[model samples]
Target chain A: MTERMQNAADAGPGPHYLALRDHLAGEIAQGALAVGARLPSERQLQLGSGAARGTVREALFQLEAEGLIYRRDRSGWYVSPPPVVYDPTRWAGFMAYVAEQGRVPTTETLGKQSVAASAADAAVFGCAIGTPLFALDRRRAIDGRPVLVERILVDPVIAPDLLDEGLDGSLTAVLTGRYGVRVVRNHVEMRPCALIKDVARALGVASGTPGLLVVRRSFDAGDRIIEYDHEYWRHDAIRVLVEVRTRD
Target chain B: MTERMQNAADAGPGPHYLALRDHLAGEIAQGALAVGARLPSERQLQLGSGAARGTVREALFQLEAEGLIYRRDRSGWYVSPPPVVYDPTRWAGFMAYVAEQGRVPTTETLGKQSVAASAADAAVFGCAIGTPLFALDRRRAIDGRPVLVERILVDPVIAPDLLDEGLDGSLTAVLTGRYGVRVVRNHVEMRPCALIKDVARALGVASGTPGLLVVRRSFDAGDRIIEYDHEYWRHDAIRVLVEVRTRD
Candidate 1:
């Protein structure tokens, strides 16, 4: 072997804190440090790295900066979960995909109310202003982490009793099975949005935290608009996948 | 009219700061506050709203928190541009879309280098590790505001003289015209990501600022993988638009 190769081999993991960082990164990449798994304490890392406490802290800070690990207020550092892949226009429910990936998904209804559609809403839905609409507010979580908060608007005529239907599960399933309105198409738009006001409060994050704002309009088989949804997702919690085929 | 409706109508706007917030929000919604246009100063808003300076500042803070307006350090507040709609898979160029929408689009080549494909990259590209790939770093802007930073990897054999040619302008156009490789399909994935280190530095944003991370793999008509790109977009600058249609 060349002299440089032999020297690198002898040095093995490199500088103190960097070596520790590399070790932790390797573990994360290899799934040894699984998503949502708590990391060792700073003291433990210090011991493992055989570096000074300050050096260990710096390495941890670097990892946090890289988005490989995150810190919660009461909780310590933990391996950041791999982002959940979402297909906004797909007919399948969020629960199905989360479960398919072996992650536990849960939905909770925050509130429900009947409201008069505003002028803007009327324009989008092609209905008169003040048309009665059912608004369902929900918080969705994966593996005990609150990830998304959604406000869904539905045409009351299509699902007259939607407010009382116990919106704790997949609204899509409920719309198909009970209301007989199946979503066959969707127009979806997503942008980065700051989590503010009630949305940040719902997701338990600070106001001004970055979030993905997803707006979707779902159409029934008859081409009637059935639902309008605004979703705010934690920036660190999800990924969206889209496949586009152009030529034959 | 009901007594409550009459009271609201008589009140006109609302409390001092809230009234000011509504007025500004209305202006933004109605496009009176044009994209990239400067917002009125705090002193001007105080004059307009007839509120105290602190109240005016509070209203401005609210608007900034809501992503309707952004401050550029010393440059004062600008009406946050309405998001540019993006379709990651469309094979259309960003320059084309921006120009069509009457916005100026420009690209700057930051740097370029050759990289040896790693094992993971080899698996994704179905190539051997250590194969040469050209890496191009670029920054794209709309209306003179930097919006996206991209790292693009291309197989050297396909576009051998790529580095010799300037890396500015439309990459898709270059590939089609120079290499005779037309993109037929793409696999796209996006997630909320924080702009950090070099990315944040390049975009001139603070570290940990929320952004969109988009990864795409483009394929030619023969299903040959041609390009892999990682893009970081300012969250407030772009929105992804996607349409999905399914049969009954």
Candidate 2:
């Protein structure tokens, strides 16, 4: 429990677990406990709070449920990193922001292929039902922690031999430089989701963990759909940031 | 199981459950099953597919886990609503957008009080410790289904008697009309979250259901923080949209 929480417990009537939970939450918000910092073990917290072991455990579980802390297998609990800010309105790619924040960013191409679009993909791509599209699946990480899985579908006609070119690094840059496809606008949507078996395995989190499902449909100067992207981000690893200004 | 799914099961090499799941998913995506439309009961699906009852149950569970459907108390499964588009960049209110979408919107004031800011709240509001702020707790609905719980913190100094002004209706309208506080810009952050116990009770969902936690810091004409609002939205109810123009 934080000192403030302890004091509140003495002055007020909430339970010990409540006080401890608030205290830890306060510590996290105040930056006294930095992101990705390994928290003291449950035994240590119990000793510090002088609370029962069960109370400490419950408090830790509460923090995890709140998405404030997370645990890796066999490794003890760690304070979650503050969510990285993503502004969908900007044309910037993942590399720009992650590097700007002084964190190492990397992308691993998991799979790449040329596939025939199904009826649904055709509708999304505004092409015939059997048009061939390039599909690129990649895992993105910041500071060696896997945070996002990106599944991108591109118009192969616009960027022929796109799959022959190396698929690593910033795909956005590749789209502009190699493919000559200029992204003019994007329509994005955000949804809360659970990590199903495949995505959960790729992200190294539990199957049912909460996540953010972001779908982006990008258009070129011709207003043609250039890319349809699905990004599954670990809930704790990123924050969606946008500024709204009144249009004059 | 959908007819397409059954057909795919006959033609493809995937498992029975996969075909069924995709069929249902396709139906939802294609708008064959409109948002909030209940799916066929397990018995109906089973009888149609000639699948065992357990297999039918498994497919429904898969859809729910994928965030495609949800069940209400004794009401059976309903197709998750298409997420309402939310553009935080605009100076609009919940009532405006919900109504524009042809859905009825209502706000219920749950609690209101003037409280001294905690250290964290103080920092967000850019005020000294112990500043008096009016906190408004409200639940918002679209078409009579609760979709959001808003916890708003405002500087009472700017809108004294705001509570006495009655805490219902569009808060943005109230700020402009009553207090003359012109909301100039808003910085919003979205995070995937699981509903905690209190919020779960308020939204009538299971405690661990996924949700979107949106934190908006509103600045007035003077560039001072006017409101720090946290809106918890049901995962299926809203999709955030933003348009970012290059500063240049």
Highest DockQ scorer: 2
TM-score of chain B of 1: 0.81
Candidate 2's docking class is acceptable
Q: How accurate locally is residue B35 in candidate 1, as Cα lDDT from 0 to 100?
A: 76
Candidate 1 per-residue lDDT, tens place, B1-248, comes to 12211112133444566667777888888998897789888788778778999888867766765567877766788888767888765657789998887889999998787866756677877888777778788899988889999888898888988988877898888888888988888889887766655677777776666788888999988888888987888777888998888856
Q: Which CAPRI tier for candidate 1?
A: acceptable
Off by over 4 Å in 2: A1-15, A26-34, A40-58, B1-13, B26-35, B40-58, B244-248
Model 1 TM:
0.85
- Error at B175, model 1, angstroms: 2.5
Least accurate 10 contiguous residues by lDDT in model 2 chain A? A1-10
Candidate 1 lDDT for residue B135:
79
DockQ of each: 0.41, 0.45
Report the C-alpha displacement of residue B157, candidate 2, in angstroms: 0.9
Best by TM-score: 2
Candidate 1: C-alpha lDDT: 0.77
